[model samples]
Target: MRKALALAATLGTLAMTRALMRDRHVPLPTALPGRRETLSAPQVGTVAYYASPEGSGRPILLIHSINAAASAYETRPLYLHYRENRPVYALDLPGFGFSDRSRRRYTPRLMADAIHAVAAEIRARHGGETIDAIALSLSCSYLAKACLARPADYATIGLISPTGFDGRLSGEGPPDGHRGREILRDVLDRPLIGPLLFSGLASKVSIRFFLEKTFGATKIDEGLLDYAYATAHQPGAEHAPYCFIAGHLFPTDSTLLYDRLKLPVWMVHGQRGDFVDYRLAPRFAERPNWRIDSLPTGALPQFERLRAVTDCYDGFLASIRPSSPRG
Candidate 1:
């Protein structure tokens, strides 16, 4: 009895020490370097974003992946690379970066709605010209749903290392219905343990580890890591990330959405890292509106091979003629 009591006391002390050592968090502002904007979505509240000067034809929208440390920073290399040739905009989504990371249930519909709202705003800014859209990983589904809701808003869509193609590849598990990890999400969303668990996952060390894994290299982008750490350290930042961890953000019908896209689609994925199993790509083998490219790196390929990625994207843009401005 004494030994058990002593062990319990030690565990309690460790938990208290950890709680004390946990970083005191305040929200981080927009880390994306450019002209910024704040727009209000009906249900999503205020959204923070960045836009480059308009040039040439229709503007481009870049959506970052959904993850524990997601932000426009994920789209940094692509934004900078494309902004040079055309107008570029990067969104903070609804619960990330400089946006309103309020405590709410982060769902695919909410995220997709956010995308739709931003796309509408961009369309008005560009005199109703349809823009090109690109999304990384899970955002691809949200983007697809947004485009589906209003196909007239987008001219073409690009996806990078998106989910769903490897649904069958992940082996057997759970009753997710292909949408997300509800059981894990339920545990993380709990009041007492949720925040503590998230703080540990969002710590600078943890962020660095994930970033390195994302790049499929021991060395990762230090600047991005810094921004990710800052963003993750923000108050209420863990809400969306926890939702993501629970698979609440990954839409199960993403494959169906991809198949339903009438606009031209350009997809890219790498052969390395944690997210590379797109063996089901052959399913789209006969899709004239769909094109896929393979990279030699991991999930965030643009950071490692910017020139190649831009060149490929440029080729996709070249294939489509910019639509005439709506009368």
Candidate 2:
């Protein structure tokens, strides 16, 4: 009886110590850019975004992946490059980055709605018009659905290392099954535990290890690690990894949405991309309007070879003139 009491006391002390440590460094929830515009979405909540007004013609919206470390700024390689010549906007999706995270279930539909809402806000600010959309990894699912739902709202669509192909193919089976579902529920549903696990796993050491292993590159930048760590530490951002692991953000029938798409579509995948099923691109490219660009790098091929990736995109953009030529 005495030993049991002592063990309990020790556990209690450890819990208190952890709680105190967590309180010691309460992280700031938001990270704003040098310049940004705030926009509100009904169900998804307010999103802090960056846009360039100097560019002409239709705007380009860059959507980052849905991950614990996701952020609009992390996708700067693409946005910063495109923003100079084209009106560009990068969004921190709900439950990720600086956006709101009140919703219990982070469904693909909810994310798609958030994308649509941001586009609407953009149109409202700069006359009634649709913008071209580019989405990466998990976000590609949401953007694809949004474009399908409102065909006229997007001038062109680009998917980079997109998901949903797993469900489309027979061998791939269901994208989320028992294990994936359990992981999702446990991660996102648990409050304190979820945040603790996120912080623990998203340490600089772990992130660097992941980047090196996944990208097959030895050179890991400290600035990128700091940015990812800072973004993951943000309030509610930790939940994104859980949602992604749980497969809540992954579109089940993403191929159906692709088949329904009416606009010009471009898909890019890295030969060594860790997060994508590169083999599936051939099937997607079978469609007349869809074109695929395979790169030599990994999932973040754009970052690995920023100049080459941007040059390819620039060429693609040049090939297509706006349906209504921009004056």
Top TM-score model? 1
**Worst lDDT window (10 residues) for model 2?**
170-179
Pick by lDDT: which candidate is best?
A: 1
Local error of candidate 1 at residue 90 (angstroms): 0.4
The TM-scores, one per candidate, come to 0.87, 0.84
The TM-score obtained by model 2 is 0.84
lDDT of 1 by residue, 250-320 (tens): 66677777767778888999888778788778887567777789899889888888888888888876776
User: Cα lDDT of all candidates, in order?
Assistant: 0.81, 0.69
Q: List runs of model 2 lying over 4 Å from the truth.
A: 2-34, 166-188, 191-193, 321-327
Supply the global lDDT for candidate 2: 0.69
**lDDT, residue 262, model 1:** 76
